[model samples]
Target: MTVVLALEKVTKSFGPVEVLHGVDLALHTGEVHALIGENGAGKSTIMKILGGYLAPTTGRVLLDGAPVTYHSGPEGEAQGVVVIHQEFNLAADLTVAGNIFLGREITRGLGLDHAAMRAATAELLARLDTSIRPEALIRDLSVPDRQMVEIAKALSRKARVLIMDEPSAALTHREVEALYAQVDRLRAEGVALMFCSHRLDEVSRLADRITVLRDGSVVQRSLRGEMTEDGMAAAMVGRELTDIFPPKDTTTGETLLEVRGLNVQNLVKDVSLTLHKGEVLGIAGLVGSGRTELAEGIVGLRPATGEIRIGGRQVQIRSPRDARAAGLAYLTEDRKEAGLLLDKNLPVNLTLSALDMWGFRIDPKREKAEMTRARKEFDIRAASDEMRTGALSGGNQQKLLLAKTMLTGPEIVIIDEPTRGIDIGTKQQIYHFVRALARQGKAVIVISSELPEVIGLSDRVLVMRMGRIAGEVEGAAITEENIVRLAMGLDREEEPA
Candidate 1:
């Protein structure tokens, strides 16, 4: 393998805070280098330097063994290095073709070559095994399709060095397999790939070499064969990860939330379940299986018809406010979009959910005090409470969202994808927090795509298939095989005849 891009003793600083410290990495042609780290561990900083979005405060970046500097992302792309950001970079108002060729349109004679751009976009999408129309507006596309658009855009640059951050975070299992196939094709073409993901299994399968970062410094770098998932996790967190999940609770109290015949329009249908105080009920299903839809319906985020009983008394929850008044709260899966006001300060976002608690005339002193307490309690890492919510890393942002949800003081809490895109260490922390909530007698519902996460954290697991409960597993019966069988509609318990 030939070295294509190399960072020698790189150190990056934002103002006075140094995030990347004396780091060194090399990307070889035809090799996938997996970058593993907890949020705030300096992975993003290093990626920014590599993508030319930021210049390293010290150290040198060498391309083809010669030192070089790129003044901007476009300059880096023009030189055969392209970055696919974790967040979607497409303009929502533009068509797929427009986004793919934005600022680099292929002009034939004079005006913008619309037909050429659309045809080229079609070819890229076809290569990625997607059927999205190039003429479709980005705002109308699903999350998965938007991700495909991002990939197609990157492919359009004819990149020699590709940097992908959490590329599979929003993809379904089938979609991920497709992405893996694309990665293999890219590698075969001798592209140097820097793949960053919190999914260790992905790193294990796709990487030729692995680099681990801890506390803004390189901790370990080794061949893929030299490290197991457990070893990599331990290295990234600097501790032996024993019992990643807390002990399951067996002493559940009386049922706190009960839903019968719940229907969320076309999304969820006739789903029934019960959650008890001191219990973490897990919901597991494939994409579009109505797991999130059911939770949204129960918490009034979506219009639904159902019999919702709180403490055995029937209640009507028509809106989020109504649900809150009924002692119920929901943490949406897309925390960056729906859950947190990213542009706002920490104090503002933290208190937004519980504004009624302080009345109409908001008290800045009380808000600041509450923000301080939540930050301490949730272990939200930030430079200061006044920092923008978007400035925090994914894990810390998730912690802040969780803190905001808990501030509503709901007796029943429903969290969707609690640790999606978060690192292993932060995931352990969230698992403990969920169990602690149950121990405090709050009924908890965890909806996740990761079967292991659902099984490890929940007292009982409910599998959904096509908008309804397929089966329930508990105790020793909640294995991956059983959950998959239930989710795929291959197995179901017989009803009393």
Candidate 2:
């Protein structure tokens, strides 16, 4: 393999606090490199520097043996380097062809020529073996369709180096397969791919090399198969991870949660379910499925006509506070928007739900004690108690969010995409934590898009499709094909069983 890009002791920092210590990374042509680390570990910082989103504090970046520094994505684009972020950059209102050649539109030696751009975009999609219509508006497209356009956009720039972060989070098995084929095509074309994901299974299949980041520094960097996941996980966390999820043997009581005639807008229609004590009920669905809305409605985050019962007692919940008071908790799908107060500190975020639990006013000792316990248990690393949570890595921030709701000790918890943007190590911790919650006799509901995660954690599974429960398939029927079939509105068994 030929060296495509290399970082020589690159160091990046923001203000007085250093986010990334001196670190080195290298990638060769025609290979997929996996970057693994905890949430606050400096993975994004390194990628940002390479992609020209941020300048390195020290050291150098070399592209094919030539030292270079970039000031923006366009500058990097001029050098054939592109970073496709987790959030799709295409404009929703624009047509696929328009987004592909947004800035560099073809012209008839004068003004913009729509004909040429559409023709070119159509060819590009066809080349990728996709039947996506270039004239179709992105707003009407699916997540997978949007991703395919993004991939086509990258190729339009002739991107030599591509960075994919959590590409599989919103994809189904079939979509993932199509994406993998595209990735292989890119790799075969001598494009160097640096991928980041929380899914170790993906890393095991795709990456030709792996680099482990821990505490703002490089812990291990080696060719493919040189290190095992167990070894990589230990290095990334700087400790032995005996069990990601704690063993659970706690037997649940009788049916602890019951829902009836739940009806909301297009997100959730008439639906109902029952959850037993100490049961982890998994809700699997594709993007835009009714799973999230159902969780929200049950917790009173959204307006709905439904009856929610805890331990056979009917309760009235109209707001988040009402939900908490009713012994229920919810972790939102979008962490930035719903789960966290990005500007706050770890203690403040962790104690968000249980402020009253600390007594009148704010007892310094009790508040500190509560925050300290969550920090230690969740393994949230920060410079000090005074440090802001926003400065932490994505993984640590997510952990603090988990600590936020669970601190209240709610009887039933609703968690949406618990490990979406986190790292593999953090994901492992969450799997154990969720299982442990059920073990402690908590009725836990996990809304997820990942099949493996749902199957691994749930005691029962509810599959949703198009604002309704498509089918309730537990134990013997929770296969990947069935879950997705229900999620995509293909399964015929309806009626919200």
Give per-residue CA lDDT, model 2, range 1-497, as digits (tens).
Answer: 88878889888777787777778888889999999887778777777788888888899999999899888978988888888776678898999999999988888877889988999999888776677899999988866678778878877888889887777766666667777888898899999999887677788789899998887888888777787777877877888777565554557679988999898765788898999889888998776677777888888888889788988999998888888888899998777656777788777777767877555366678779987888788887777777776667677777788888888879999998898878767788889888878877889999887787887787779988888788888776778888877777776656895
User: What local distance difference test score does each model get?
Assistant: 0.91, 0.82
TM-score of each: 0.96, 0.82
Number of colliding residue pairs in each model: 0, 4
Over 4 Å off in model 2, which ranges?
A: 13-22, 87-153, 225-231, 238-243, 266-269, 316-318, 343-370, 384-388, 407-409, 465-497
> Which residue pairs collide in model 2, if any?
39-393, 39-395, 40-393, 245-432
lDDT of 1 by residue, 1-497 (tens): 99999999999888899888899999999999999999999888888889899999999999999999999988899889999998788899999999999998989788999999999999998888877999999998877788889988998888999999999988888788888998999999999999899999999999999999998899899997899999999999999999999998558999999999999988998888899989999999998899888988888888999799999999999888899899999999988778899999998998897887667567899898888899889999899888889999999999999999999899999999999889999999999999999989999999998888998998899999999888999989989999999999888566799
Task: Output the TM-score of candidate 1.
Answer: 0.96
